[model samples]
Target chain A: MARASLREDIVNAAVEQFHMFGFTAAGVKDITDAAGAPKGSFYNHFESKEALAVIALERYGATRGLAALGDTSVPPLARLRWHFEALRDENLAYGFSRGCLIGDLATEIADHSEVVRKAVQDSMQQWCDALSGTIAEAQQAGEVTKALEADTIARFVLSAWEGALVSARSDKSAKSFEAFFTVVFGVVLR
Target chain B: MARASLREDIVNAAVEQFHMFGFTAAGVKDITDAAGAPKGSFYNHFESKEALAVIALERYGATRGLAALGDTSVPPLARLRWHFEALRDENLAYGFSRGCLIGDLATEIADHSEVVRKAVQDSMQQWCDALSGTIAEAQQAGEVTKALEADTIARFVLSAWEGALVSARSDKSAKSFEAFFTVVFGVVLR
Candidate 1:
């Protein structure tokens, strides 16, 4: 029981550390320190930092609250807005110090680590799929324009949000988020 | 003359190093070695890696071909497409190994380094200003929708391109770029 608990703790700490400091900057020692475990014990649970990072990306994707996009209880457009609004609020709550972990990993370490690259790709595909499904529903209901493919819009929206996070992190302001909302919701989807 | 040339070499190499390996993962030795200069000579030209990064960002911004946006000879929308096409082609030529230096630095080191944060903000603002000008011209020529403000569209487009680069790097393909072009040019801008 203790061994399994320690492993879980390491994974949790890794998610936090990788999100905050990025994959290359954060070390096993930092993760273990945050987990209150011995640094040497990191090897017992994971084969390498690369392995741990893949797990961290998976945890991040799972916790991203993406299921809200498919709730079907609310209007599709409203559900989409709520989803991004929740993300924007989270960034603001953290003072914009933490950008999206998937984006951070994709930009910083994806080129170097094939495993990490695949993990980020999988996460992106999953996100694109979720957004695409919601968008198609919206299109069918005439809430969104059918002038373009839902999948294309989904991937573009994902990119815009990712880019907005990067801008928000740099400017430490809500200006980028505002731009994203105004253009994406006000114009593109409409 | 040698000293001046070495300083330029270091700045150029720092830009390449930061873009390829990122800020935290890259070090002074790597930049100096790439510049073919002695590692000890790094401090003689720049106060710290952070300072070098600011100068490198300036160099990157200056070379981004933003001036093309203001050239009145061609149609504004055509100029805009050409700018992004050049960037996309560059990414493909490099095998998508190097993402945008500004986006990479903005995500990786902007929060930790105030100087770099300002530099990245400046680069973003510069890019935004250039795009906003071109977009406004496109709107004036009836080439783009004027429903959303030009600056908002500009910032959103910037974010989308940055996000697309992140996607392209992770997927090692042009699909993200294709989505970006399709949505921005085919739908949003239209």
Candidate 2:
């Protein structure tokens, strides 16, 4: 039980470093230092930095206040909007310094780390799958255009969203994200 | 003349490293070694790795097939589509491996490197400015909806497109980018 909790601490510490410095730039020593754990503990828990990043990506998602997005109880577009708004608020709270971990990894490490790359791909797939379900519902309810498949539209929405986050981070402001939310909710969806 | 050419070679090599390995992961030694220049020459030219990245980004954008996007001689929607299509083709040519350099920096380094971060912000700003011009022209011609400012719509399009590249890199396929092209041209533009 103690070991499991220590493992959680390691993962949690890793998320912050990876969030701040990227997967490759944030060394294992930094992660262990942040966790207050011995260097051996890092090796005992994860095989490589790539392994830790895969886990970090999941841990970041788990705590990002997006559980409600997958509830399926709320309307599709509303849930989608809620997810974006929450991200916007969180990003603003961080002063736009901390963008999405998975996105950061996807951009920087996807070409280099197959393990982390697969994890990012899976996370995105998971998000798209959940989003598509809601978008399908929206389409059936005549809330969205049916010209494209639920999955494809979901992909489109999700992709544009990732781009918006990048824009927000680059500008160090939420206007890019707000622009995304506005265009998505106001024009793209309509 | 020799010095000028040597500087160009350094930027070109650094871009490949940055494009493949990211800004932080691509070491200065690697960049200089790739350039066939003395490792110490790197410091003589740029104050920091962040400084080189700013220039690398500009060179990458210069080589991309987007010069005509700002020409204004072409129709607005046509220029916008051409801009995206050229990117899609470039990504496809790289087998969906080399994504946008500015986006890569925006995702991976925006928080840590202010120099690189501001450079990315400027690049996105320049793209939006050019895109807004074309979009505004399209709106005047009734080619696009006049419901929103060309700048906002341009921001939306640019953000979504950046997200699409992330998606494409995650999946190791161009389908996500192509989907973006389809949605923007078919649905969003209409």
Candidate 3:
């Protein structure tokens, strides 16, 4: 494989492992083998497994979470709903066996590892920023209500969705995901 | 320590380790050392580290999580708020360095370990049950909306609080927790 393709392959493989098994429990050897890359090349591309894991989380959010939130044609609140629905679908796709890479890493990765921890923190902030912007627009249009500040509600909505994902993964059920949507739309915003 | 006290100490130590280091990364040796007990004594009390980890999770929930939800004097939603605020305070005590042990274990512990996963699942269900009862009462009192089912709302609130905890640990800030409370009470319950 070409150099660029090999690097991308390694990162993709690592992200899959981190999603399935957290950043800490997942072995680098398994990651490399999945990528079909040699062990020596993993070091050449990244400083450590933790570094690759961070990259994986950011990439996943950009492609999956942020992409849905950034869709402008959809109404702002609907876009927010879309973002969570996509996540719920993704979790179900995994048979509720795994969870968000960022949320999982924040809980599983060692706190002593500053770099990895910061990466997880930053990724979460990025989602809040994305959702917050849409929430601001929704508030202006009266779709989300003006009772609370856009930023605060945005953060709260993010927490509920993430928490719902936590329950989904732990219980291996879709009940938490469905219930989360009902409250957020049928009650909170309504 | 007496044999029973020694077992309690070991379990308490294991709980702390699981909170700090997660289920898979935390070692048996460290749990014993933290308990100031011998390694040999560990297996004598518990069949495996997995068994001990499950017990630790159950114990923590009884004292911290379920206890707050089970408080009868407080109104339903306020009791739920109390439960999350208590958790937020506990996280701040740790400098926002760790997260829920059950959440961490659900993502960290290997999926094939059915016993440990079931323990995490059941503990979550227990909280959902406790919250659902209070929610039904609140709905009857007109404190919460009649639009959503009490059981569904209960599950969503729990997920949101748990998800907020995830963010609190990730950002090392109380922002998510504060936002969670504001919207949950001000919007959903209102």
Give the Cα lDDT of each candidate: 0.92, 0.83, 0.81
Q: Name the top DockQ candidate.
A: 1
Give per-residue CA lDDT, model 2, range B5-113, as digits (tens).
7777788999999998888778999999899888888887888888899999888767755568767787878888888888888888887776899899888888878
Tell the DockQ for candidate 3: 0.74
Separate clash counts for every candidate: 0, 2, 1
Measured as a fraction from 0 to 1, the native contacts recovered by model 2 come to 0.87
Name the TM-score of candidate 1.
Answer: 0.97
Best-fitting candidate, scored by TM-score: 1
Q: Worst lDDT window (10 residues) for model 2 chain A?
A: A61-70
The reply for model 1, stretches above 4 Å from the true place, is A1-3, B1-3
Question: What range of 10 consecutive residues in model 3 chain B has the weakest lDDT sum?
Answer: B103-112
**lDDT, residue B139, model 1:** 97
lDDT of 2 at B181: 77
For every candidate, how close is chain A to the native chain A in TM-score? 0.98, 0.92, 0.92
Instruction: Calculate the i-RMS of every candidate, to one decimal place.
Output: 0.9, 1.1, 1.5
Order of quality (TM-score): 1, 2, 3
Residue-wise lDDT of candidate 1 within A56-142, one digit each (tens)? 999999977789999999999998899899999999999988799999999998999999999999999999999999999999999
Better model by lDDT: candidate 1 vs candidate 3: 1
Tens digits of per-residue lDDT, candidate 3, B69-176, equal 657788777876777778788888988877777777776763658888889898888888988887887788788878788889889988888888788888888898
